[model samples]
Target: MMISEVSEKFDIPQDTLRYYERIGLIPHVNRNKSKIRDYTEEDCRWVEFVKCMRSAGLPIEVLIEYVGLFQQGDETVEARKELLIEQRTQLKARMEDMKKTLERLDYKIARYETGIAQTEKILRRPET
Candidate 1:
């Protein structure tokens, strides 16, 4: 697949895909005879993995490190596992914090809804 096709399929901007390739956040993509990127299935899978990690709030440096480990072959399996575990732990903490914030917002909104209902009811009452 061409770079544009991959970008469109993944809903990622073309330039960002280029940047990921440039920074080693994802593996190098093969180029065509004319020097245009020709992404293979494996390359597209790499792009998908990188996009998933990025969506989970993984840092660029960490992804670059993970890709670097991946490129080093089987010896880095344990390292890769540790990296993913650490990132997962961090993601979990962030999710918890976001959950708390969401709960607070829900509470505040419900309070506002109740207050508005009361105000509307009072306004609709017949004057003494």
Candidate 2:
């Protein structure tokens, strides 16, 4: 597929895709006769993987390292796995922090709701 199609399909912008290629975040994409990007299935898979990792908050440097290891052949399997495990651990900690923040926000909202209700009740009372 063309770069535009890949961009639409992946919900990523063309410039970001080109940046990814330039930064070695994804492997080199093949170009067609006219020098337009022709994304193969493997290339799309790399895009998907990188997108998922990025959404999960994996650092760009870590991903670049992982991709580098991937390009070095099968001998780097364990190293890649270790990198993924470390990222996963970081993601879990971040998730926990987010959960706590959400709970605090919920509590604050509830308290505000209660205060509003009490004020409304006082306002609605009959005046002498």
Candidate 3:
């Protein structure tokens, strides 16, 4: 498929896709006879993988390293797994932190609700 199709299909902007290719975030995409990008299935898979990793907050540097390892053939399999494991650990920690923050906000909101109810009750106590 063309670059525009890939961009639309992946819901990513064309410039971002170009940037990803330029930065080695995804492997170099093949160009057609006219020198335009022709995204193959493998290329699209890379795009999807990179997009998912990025959404999960994996750092660009880490991803670049992982992609580099990927290009180095089968000897780096364990190393890639280790990298993914490390990123997953970090993502889990971040999720835990976000969960705690949400709980705190909920607690604060409940307290405010209770306080407002009490105030309303006092105000309705017949003015004296």
lDDT (0-100) at residue 61 of candidate 3?
96
- Runs in model 2 with CA error above 4 Å? none
Q: List the residue pairs that clash in candidate 3.
A: none
Worst 10 residues of 3 by lDDT: 119-128
Better of 1 and 3 by TM-score: 1
For residue 41, give model 1's deviation from the true position in Å: 0.7
Q: Model 3, residue 9: displacement in angstroms?
A: 1.6
Instruction: Quote the lDDT for 107 in model 3.
Output: 100
lDDT of 3 by residue, 1-128 (tens): 99999999999999999999999999999999999999999999999999999999999999999999999999999999999999999999999999999999999999999999999999889965
Q: Rate residue 122 of model 1 by lDDT.
A: 97
Q: What is candidate 1's CA lDDT for residue 123?
A: 96
C-alpha TM-score for every candidate: 0.98, 0.97, 0.90
Q: Score each candidate by Cα lDDT.
A: 0.95, 0.96, 0.96
Error of 3 at 35 (Å): 1.3
Candidate 3: segments with Cα more than 4 A from true spot: 122-128
Q: Is candidate 2 or candidate 3 better by TM-score?
A: 2
- lDDT (C-alpha) at residue 127 in model 1: 94
